[model samples]
Target: MNRFDRFLAIDWSGAMGERQRGIQIAYLDIEAGTGPVLMRLPDAKNWGRVVIKNLLMKLARADRRTLVGLDFCFSVPWPEEGPLPEGEAPLDRVEELWDLVENICSGEAHYYAGPAIRSMESAFAPYILCDRYRGDEFRFDRFRETESQLSPKPASIYHCMGAKQIGPGSFAGMRMFHALRAVNDHRIAIWPFDPIEDANVVLCEMYPSLFYQMAGLKRAYDHETIQNTLAYFHSGSPPRMSIQDEADAVISVAALRALAADPTLFSDPRRVAAAQREGWIFGLAPS
Candidate 1:
């Protein structure tokens, strides 16, 4: 397993907007001997996906191994090809899935993927159960094998409705992956999709809730709970955070630093072949 110089945890959001307040980023420097701090860009309060991408590019170019945990699914379960444009062939792999998402959401501002999703709302209507996009075939079933390994069985990539629905973030994140790959090559790698032995930056899926659970908390809504959570990782209290997202980010990165060194994380994820295309969550064991 590779040791990282820095750990970044993002509480990502895909809500439609020019800027998303729910998207929070925090990082910890392994050599700094300090706690995780919410990353504040020079002029941005809320983060736009494009800005996040640029930050990632800068990190990719840096000559240090960095572990970045993005709070979203990397790929959908390969339930056959989603509704494709006429004459387009079904995608064979995750990168191709990213390309398809990029094509569908091209020109979308703030990297919002509403258009790409709305385009397929009809074909996948049965899977979506949200009030607005509820499909006739909506059934709360279907999940990647890796996800099924977790106790709660986090939402399926196909679940596009309700609060747990991370489908929007998943789709938008794919576009970011595609964009990063187009420019950076081996500098940055999304684990389980792109090989990572020589990459300076590596990205993986994260679920902040898992870390909070480790500390016996539900959410980092208060400073005391935040302190307790960080303490579990031997980290100091986070700087005063006003929003829940900020607290989540702070705790998450601290947890990432604590969990990144496990050798199992760098090993094969599961028996399912789709796992290569549909990535695994970083800290969770595939067993």
Candidate 2:
């Protein structure tokens, strides 16, 4: 297995407007002794998707072996009922899904305000409902198999509304994935879809909540909690953090550090089958 030299954790957002405050980027160098540091956009309050895409392209050009963790559902649950429309092929592969989402949801964010997803005359239409989001009614990917067992179960990627909802973020994330793939010409290796191989940049789906649980910490944007979590990951003593800081990013980078130390995390036997189609979270145990 190729060891990553750098780990990046991105806390994503799908809200309207030119910029989103919910977006946060954090990274750590395996050779660095200190904890992860937050990245700031120049003269901007928040990061736009384009800016992030450019940054990643630069990283790839630099020949850096980086593992990027974006906090969003990489793909939705495959339709369980029947075959899709004749031309609308099943999303059995991640690249195929990315192309589909980019083609359908181009030029707008939040999937062009849900109507685009609702109007999608394809097999995935049922799962992206703006209202009435239920995961049990629909089966998610293999990575989400343990979702119900965990506290604060994750909302379905189709659920686009409400504070705890994840649908909007996922829709926006798919758009980003599409853009990144175009810029890189499909050179980026998205885990499960393509083997790790000798790819310079590897992208994976991430759930910050799982990292918090692993670190034995509660969900709060406080200095002490961030410090404690960093301490748990051997990031040395945590640096001072503000309540306004994006604490999830810090915790996520620390979690990536832990994951990088263990090769078994990436070599799970179950990943061979389910991950190729359904997608999987980076550090989640097999269900």
Candidate 3:
């Protein structure tokens, strides 16, 4: 694994709109003692996926060794028959799935607001159906290392309903991945799939809850909660943050910083195959 000069965390949103309040970006330089700082979006409202993609490409073009953690699943559990349309050969690799989803789900916010995914489920064999699966019956990617450990358990990428669900975010994120790969003329690497050491920018899936637990903090979004979490990362001193910002952004950056400090968290010999196909969360330990 390469040592990154900068660590960035994106708290992504699945909510519909040209802009969303749930989206936020935070970063910490290896040398900045003040700790993580949230990047300001223009208009101080919400960030559109296009704006986010441009900022990332700008960073890659600058040749900065950066590791970006986006809070969404990279891929869902591989269905028994694969995600390809009928008669098409099984996807030879995970990048194929990214291309497949992007090709099918492009121009549709949150992957056409669920219907696109439903269509996908219908077209593929051994369907990972979104409307039908519930609870334990829902399939999870083998690389979802945090699901068993996190509370309420992580929902399947197919479960697209109710509060605290990750389905919509994962859908939107895969579309963003497609856009990001195309925007820079193909200069980025989704980790474990592409060679991290060779890519200009490394992108990984991240879960804020994992970091929040490691920091010994509750999942609260208040001023005091955010301040206390910042203190954990800043040698017991709180970093300044705007109350208007969401707590996940702050927690994500801190979690990313922690992952950067410890190399072992990124290296798991046993899950290499799973990581390439299903995608692993950055800091998850192998079962």
Candidate 4:
């Protein structure tokens, strides 16, 4: 039976691998195999290509049924194709990169290429629900439920791809990226970020007490966001002294989700961690 053997959770950004601290931080998750990689790219130009290239290559090499999830807008309405009026020709790189991702994740290419991670906006029709952060839970009956704040005008076909009114760093923005990818790719599965409603039960499987303690630290062993703490643990490194300790914990949460999905396919925690020292450790197998 064909089943998933490995997976990758990516928090991608245009500025990935170009942070002042170091660009390699994104791969920290993939390399460490501890949590969700913080993919802070430098900009939009080659970002899409760079991400896809690495992802595709990794999936190819693993020779396993791998699922890669990313929180980013992957689709946009095809604008009127015409000649640029002035000096905007060089920017064609953006569209080109977008096409690459769309093609790889959609139609016939996706079935053979690999699995995709998309957001709620896409047409994948995956069910999702959200806790609404209000403490009062709400279920999303539709494939996608947009925020009530959008205004008098209804959402357009392109609404999913536009910059969310809330701006970056907010979960709202993440949804736009996911929706775009969903519409573009047939194989990708789109979902929401709500804890209670989403089918991605992995987010809820972490050791909470340990997870929170690690997540709420002053300094991180590695320079990761507060949401990435747990992912670092898979690297065999204990929490470091940094303000971003919570980041490590968050990362760890992602790793555990991957681990819980199919524990038998993973290695002993001790052995898997040891392999991390040699190079990137995506996952382990049962001993």
Best by TM-score: 1
lDDT by residue for model 1 (181-275), tens: 79956788888777777888889888888888888777758867888989998897688688888888898899888887776666756344767
Error of 2 at 42 (Å): 2.5
Candidate 2 Cα misplacement greater than 4 A, ranges: 79-89, 109-125, 128-152, 184-187, 237-245, 269-272
Q: Decide which is better by lDDT, 2 or 4.
A: 2
Residue-level lDDT of model 3, residues 1-287, one tens digit each, is 43887888888877677677778888777776656777886677777666777778887886667889898888766545665445666786766776777766665763433434556443332334455443333345432444544565666666566666676677678777777766654457787566666566788888877776666877777766666766666533334555433567767777677666676666672355656677777777766
Top model by lDDT, which number?
1
Error of 4 at 162 (Å): 16
1 against 4, candidate with superior TM-score: 1
- What candidate 3 gets wrong by more than 4 Å, as runs, is 79-89, 107-113, 118-152, 183-187, 235-245, 269-271
Model 4 misplacement above 4 A = 1-4, 15-49, 57-61, 73-287
Candidate 4 weakest ten by summed lDDT: 141-150
Which lDDT values do the candidates have, in the order given?
0.78, 0.68, 0.66, 0.31
Tell me the lDDT of model 2 at 77: 55
For model 2, give the 10-residue run with minimal summed lDDT. Answer: 134-143
lDDT of 2 by residue, 1-287 (tens): 43888988888877765577788888888777677888887695788666777777777776668889998877765435322333455555666777776776676653332433455443456544455443233334322443444566777665555687776667677777777777764447777566675777888888888877777877777767777777777776544455333788878888887786677666672354545566678887665
